[model samples]
Target: MFFRKTVPVALLAASVFAISTPMALAAGKGEMFMGQFTTEHGTTSHPMGDVHARLNPTTHELTYSIHWSGLTGDVNAAHFHGPAAADQEAGVLVPIDGPYTSPLKGKVQLDSQQAAELEAGQVYVNLHTQAYPNGEARAQLIKH
Candidate 1:
């Protein structure tokens, strides 16, 4: 299998996505999740979108997929935030190191503690950037 570490950046991103297919098939179907984020703009106005996710329990990792319209800028970063409440979601558990392209794709490698947070239903994913000083979009996560 070609991991990002073994390939050129362009090739790496491609392979990362390609590898997921079989890995997806081998593992039990991951839980499907969806969320609505208020965003830094206050979740009260303008345009926004949803977040999609799949968790690989065995790897203790989560794939966050974000899609939005009228996003002010390119996606600068993505993250998993939480330890908050149902409508009061909190901080970030993982900082997605990215120069993310559209769809703002990335992987979050969770340690035992992060995994625990997710299983506890206290985690979510968010998209951030310059234009979206607060946030461009967000999706609160829940196991399906």
Candidate 2:
């Protein structure tokens, strides 16, 4: 029901987490994901960015990093929106706080439903800016 990516970063993190977090190791290997953000996918053409995320199935922990560039205005907000197909839009599933600057890093523990949706590649990361109050850039989550 879960697909694990044996990327070096994931493997290395898994080893480290294994030492202090046996449950994480026992839960299983982490799944790696990538998202390429662009204005074309959003409601308007005003910003662009990239997002990286890892999900530890056993722990329900979602670790993420986002890099944004070419923003037309200040980043007003960002979130992990979900359960939508590539061509559709959906409600917010997780709120992402900042270091509003580039290379944002954080983690959130997901609920069972969210975890399932993530594993099924139904979630996405969206960056919003003042110019595009709705959304400036968006990237659909997909297992890497």
Candidate 3:
């Protein structure tokens, strides 16, 4: 009786661990980042937008999706600027390839420094329009 109960309990525990291990590993495989854009965050007033990004640390690939509307004018340019605080500005770390329309989505591989800055929450997305050549809206990426 003792041997039978021990075998069943051991098998059950092993099965539970096997099922849960992959889930735990998958959860830890990547990090998510998000941001909300507004004229308030930019150098000029225009409109609002938002971004969602995922970073795979092992592969150093950053995938992102951005959406916006009602800006002062058409989008002239967009970029990811980094290694700076929210109130400060920095040079572009990544240039968003265009048509420069809304709901932009893409992926890029990051260098070590860029990956570090992104992971540290020192990165931001900026949208520029014809009216606000500097920036129409901005959102700082925050890790989740």
Best by lDDT: 3
- Inter-residue clash pairs, candidate 2: none
lDDT of 1 by residue, 60-114 (tens): 7777777676566677777788775566757778887766765666777888787
TM-score of each: 0.66, 0.76, 0.77
Q: Per-residue lDDT of 101-120 in model 3, one digit per residue for the tens?
A: 78899988889899999988
lDDT of each prediction vs. the true structure? 0.71, 0.83, 0.86
Sort order, TM-score high to low: 3, 2, 1
The residue-level lDDT of candidate 1 at 63 comes to 79
Taking the tens digit of each residue's C-alpha lDDT, what string does model 2 give over 1-144?
A: 133555766788888877968766566678998888867434535456788998988788999999888877777799998999777788999999875788889998899899999888899888887778778788888998
In angstroms, give how far residue 5 of model 2 lies from its true place.
42
Candidate 1, residue 120: the lDDT equals: 74
Worst 10 residues of 1 by lDDT: 38-47
Model 3 TM-score, all chains together: 0.77
State the displacement of the C-alpha of residue 3, model 3, in Å, after optimal TM-score superposition. 14
Query: Model 1 off-target regions past 4 Å?
Result: 1-26, 41-45
